[model samples]
Target: MAHDILISGIRRWARLPVAGRIAIVYLLARLITTGLLLLAAHASTPQSRFGLSPSMGQLVLGWDAQWYWWVAENGYPSQLPLTESGEVAENSWAFMPVYAFLAKGAGLGEWGAGALLVSLVAGFFGCLVLHRLLRDRIGSSAAMWAVTFFACGPLAALFQVGYAEALFVLLLLIALDLVLRRRYAPLYLVLPVMGFTRPGILAFALFLGLHGILRWMRRRAEPLPARHIVHIVALGAFATVIGFAWQAIAAVVTGNPSAYLSTELAWRRNWLTDPSAQFVPFEGFVRGAEFWMGQAGLPSWSGWLLLIVLVAGAAALLLRSPHVRRLGPEIRLWSASYLLYLLAVFFPQSSTLRLLLPLTPLWGALAVPRSRLYRWGMLGLCLLAQWIWILCMYGLAQTFWQVP
Candidate 1:
């Protein structure tokens, strides 16, 4: 009887629309994963990292979640806290304000755990919006595969966590969809919110700029309308200025004009001996690779070589994919610019894979294979990778520097 009911539910789920199926599958997977994690948390020693939350649901609120919760519960410190030597300590200024702001107003009894609920709900809708965006380009079948691949990604656990990736991705896709549809009016509303949420808005803005240039070139024979002129100028300004709003707020609140930048640099400074040193791009990844490789008795440069190979492989696969080729200029530019932003500004750090969540459209490219065997094989591998990531990076990550 129980087996029949479960099979019946699976049939019903399969009969639903692509978006509905995506949502149901994603939420149900999250439910089972969360329950199992909670059970494991309860079974462990209370003092361990994995045991940080026996409540299971709160397990998603791990490291960065604490920083966001700080902003939500206490707000930014009027006076930035400093170390004994006058250096800036890690604080809420490093985190953007959108998730914190929403979590604060959620009215959940505990503001910190409320963030997890916010993330889960946002993730569900984000998946649906992602499916919708892909469906317009690929047909419904390919789009469904894209969403499935996204939901079961190795880093997909981050979506269930209290991170702002879900919210940021949802806003970005909505804004991108509006642009694709030539709906500029609603973008004004989302662009500002996106700017407030994450620095990825700059990439989105660049994508929009590229889209505009291509459109103008195609329509060069036609005279530019007053409305197009307004939209082009307005959107460009919105993207450029809004990305820096949080930095301005941080500067003003902390009373140090460079508070935001300094705080960001300070994270790098933590591992460096020189307090006055500047952050060098790829330095962290190189250094991290050296340390881990040395432990395995490998040459220090092997780490650097490995990173180069991995990046090159990913790029080759991305560019060669038929699904990626089907993407419009806007998405292609957005993906490229966003990856550059990650490389140049964000730096190759521990959370780099998790940061790639905003490039949700890449999953569509990965899903382009028409073979059922290939799709199912990739899905199975992704699920296995998720389990491994959870165990090594989250569950038994007590003594390691596991950044999710």
Candidate 2:
């Protein structure tokens, strides 16, 4: 029977390892998460979030969510001149084209419906890829924890309302997986998607491509196989060149290489130049610490609490073993890419919660350390921090989007 064959396929996966299990469960949990949302939707009033239902393509995602909806509903913008002038105002560089393309794919539903379609499939694939990378390099247990952590966090929360984070995280994990498997060709292909999604992703694609090249060059005397090296170099060249080209287009259109950085993300960039722009303003580092420790935006102590544990865990994971260091650069790169983004957002506040969500993979890895006491302690701290952040974010989202 087809049912028996399907059940047998599902049951035959124990050979994969803990990471494989986690990866399997991560995808399984997403289905369950979707089901939970659908059930809640049907149980509640049509407009009442707590009592609504999910039609096949309904959308309930939040924040700037409506913009994607507009694109999905209406289709791409055609450039048109103003009625009284010759000035041409195109769609501008503020919005990317992919979300609209997606909206249209979801029967022209925009971001909300399109997001659900994009993320559910993509994020599920992401879990499988993350698991494969871990299984091939590290143990399955480490992979499982990493995938599990991601599935439980704010990253997963995006499933309810369709957000960029879901798609972003999936592409990120896929690109990393390709590198881990030495499948440079597929990695290069995925990088462009990341670049289109966020300008910062060009940096990620370039760095990963470069690392793969240097790795091949270092293995020059091993006599492994010249054909594979040629393939890798070719792929790296494509990603690096093409990735930068797209970024250049964005810069030229915006009239400054960094215009997109500032024009679209004014609040984020203000902290870099303006002294008074910080969430907690103070003179000395110590004074800044004191100010930050008492701020309302970041919950005073939770920010510092996350900082201490994050750094300590990072050091431990780095020192774990030479094998881990050699085979699993994806783990390090995964954390590093976001660190680059967060360090750029040093002013006002770090947007610590958003910065922390994607690092769930790293946190899960850190939890696997030999220092059981320290690991559990840090884990507890992280869980508490995650809880506080979720409740706070839920309140903020509700206030902004749920207000009738």
Candidate 3:
């Protein structure tokens, strides 16, 4: 009788409205993550960044969150700070203003509280939108499973932190959904917010260009209207403008033409043997590959070979994998575009896992497998990975490599 009652309860839960189901899942995931965080906090030592027995607030507001708070407390500096060597130092210009200012506007009495509230709300909504985005392509069951994987994945810490990723991802999922539906006008509004929310809008802009070309090639079959062509072209141009607008704004304020680029390069300097290397598109990854390989006691040539294999393997998977192909063209295109963007600009480091958050939509492809064992095993792995990530990044943040 007890077994039957439990089964009936689960059946009722499964019958709830999609939003209700998502809310329940999201809440549970947050609870689990919170528990893991608490565990990490208890285990934290004076050696850790958070110190011994730190609170949830401290853990959330540590690392880059401190920068966001600095931005909120004091706006970007009119004059850039410099090192003893006269190179630009990392400053508020490295972070975008949207998340910081929005947290301030939340008026939650404390910056950490406000930032946490924003991340929590945005993360829940992001899951809902993710479900909606994936459900149409894959069935509701698979979509829900994908959301579960996303909520409980390795970077689940993002949902509870003061970072802009949750909000940026919420906006990105909405934008991607709008694009897949061919609703172009809404994107004009979405693009600006997304651009300000994070650094990934350039990837989205590139995806738009590729999407336009793909539509044009299939125009005979799908009948591309002239108005859509115009919308696509205009929206792509608008996104490109927004992508660079921040740099221009930084330049005007600081009275230095390369203010933003120099500020970004400041962070890259930490890992480079030649601190004065210029920003070259696609060179970061190549250098990062060699750097990390050397740190791991491997040959430099092996790093180059590994990078080639990884890039080629990723291309092959996107082009030929049955599971990924089931996700349809828009998702596959976005994934490819984002990966390319990362290779072009980002220097891989401990934060690379966090940077890959934009590819969350591909979780749907992993959910395409229907075996109960496969699904449950993957969930177990995700939870384990999440705990490991929290412990390394928060509990024992003793080295630069442990950064989240």
Candidate that scores best on lDDT: 3
TM-score of each: 0.86, 0.64, 0.98
Model 3 agreement with the true structure over 1-404: per-residue lDDT tens digits: 99999999989998899999999999999999999999999989999988899899899898899999999999899999998988998999989999998987884658888899899999999999999999988899999999999999999999999899999999999999999999999998999999998899999999999999999999999989999999999998999999999999999999998999899989987788585446789888898899999999998999999999999999998999999998999999999999999999888899999999999999999999999999999999999999999999999988978889
lDDT of candidate 1 over 1-404, digit per residue (tens): 99999999979877887766786779766865565465546554554576654555556667688788778777787787787878887777888888887876763657666677777777778778878788878777788888887777777776767788888888988887887777788988999888877678777767767777877886766565678767967897789788777778888877888788777767765444553444566555666666657768999889788878877876765577666877656677678778766765554445777788888887887777789999999988887777766655566555534566
Candidate 2 structure lDDT:
0.52
Compared with the true structure, model 2 gives a TM-score of 0.64
Give candidate 3's whole-model lDDT. Answer: 0.93
| Cα-based lDDT at residue 288, candidate 2 | 33
Residue-wise C-alpha lDDT for candidate 2, range 216-266, written one tens digit per residue: 666755343666666666665665676557546666654556433333343
Please name the candidate that would achieve the greatest TM-score relative to the true structure. Answer: 3
Ranking by lDDT: 3, 1, 2
Candidate 3 Cα outliers beyond 4 Å, as residue runs: none
